[model samples]
Target: MKPKKILLMGVSGSGKSLIGSLIAQRLAVPFYDGDDYHPEKNVKKMRQGIPLSDADRQGWLRTLNRLFVNNDEVVIACSALKNEYRETLRQNNEDMIIVFLRGDFDTIWSRHKQRTDHYFNGEDMLKSQFETLVEPTLDEAIFIDITHNAEDVVNAVMRALQN
Candidate 1:
């Protein structure tokens, strides 16, 4: 069956929000940018260049997970950088299809440098995310390289979901 619950995951600057929103629009589903759900304290910490500890994210992850539970179909762009975080999101939403947007640090950093209006755009925070990333294998997710243009990337995700 075509997946109705999709989570686009990666470190910041990997285009999760852009690709996820496009995929959701194509599928006629709702799109939720996980960044929007973060607690204000977390945002403040990130804005000050502090890396969030797992404790800081527990409530936030659960909140995002509820979005999955409450919706029949949803596309969420989240930086589920750790396996535990992904597990938190999958609690009652086992059918969720995770799309890992893969890209090297240099490629993502180049993109990050161009962003001007986000609280989590620090180079150190991006590096911290990479360090915390527990990449899901092919069995765990549909991996899409983020070097492609946004349209191409979304097309790739759509094709993967068709399978």
Candidate 2:
């Protein structure tokens, strides 16, 4: 199969990075972390448990778009919580395929609570992420329920792509 650009998108603690890395490795493509593209100010605000406004995210999304522009085949892990953010990315690269990782709030919250050294805390930001999530409609993009193991999730996506 030819490698294609993919966006692994979901809220924090939903395992976007973990799954994206595995998928990228399987596809022999480079993987980028969208968090690394965030401006220092945005990082600081999130570190302080503050939700960022759209203005704060605009530059970050553009940075992600640049990565796609430069790479032929890549997988990116991002908390693309809103439709506008996804649309901006698509505008930059129409071939970009969004892989929406859908997980229940409790599952993500427990995962977040177990993590250490991350900027986002589940208690402070989970609600905001859930609120921001505009679950992709059938005609919008590929959506996957992430209630299974990581490998299983990846396999499911791979199988879906094959069809």
Clashes of each: 0, 0
lDDT of each: 0.94, 0.87
Per-prediction TM-score, please? 0.98, 0.95
What tens digits encode model 2's per-residue C-alpha lDDT throughout 106-132? 999988889999987657688888887
Which residue pairs of candidate 2 clash? none
What TM-score would you give candidate 1 relative to the actual structure? 0.98
Q: Name the runs in model 1 displaced over 4 angstroms.
A: none
Candidate 2 lDDT trough over 10 residues, lowest sum: 134-143
Residue pairs in candidate 1 whose N, alpha carbon or C atoms collide under 3 angstroms? none
* Top model number, TM-score: 1
Per-residue lDDT of 79 in model 2: 86
lDDT tens readout by residue for model 1, 25-133: 9999999999999999999999999999999999999999999999999999999998899999999899999999999999999999999988986788889999999
lDDT, residue 23, candidate 1: 92
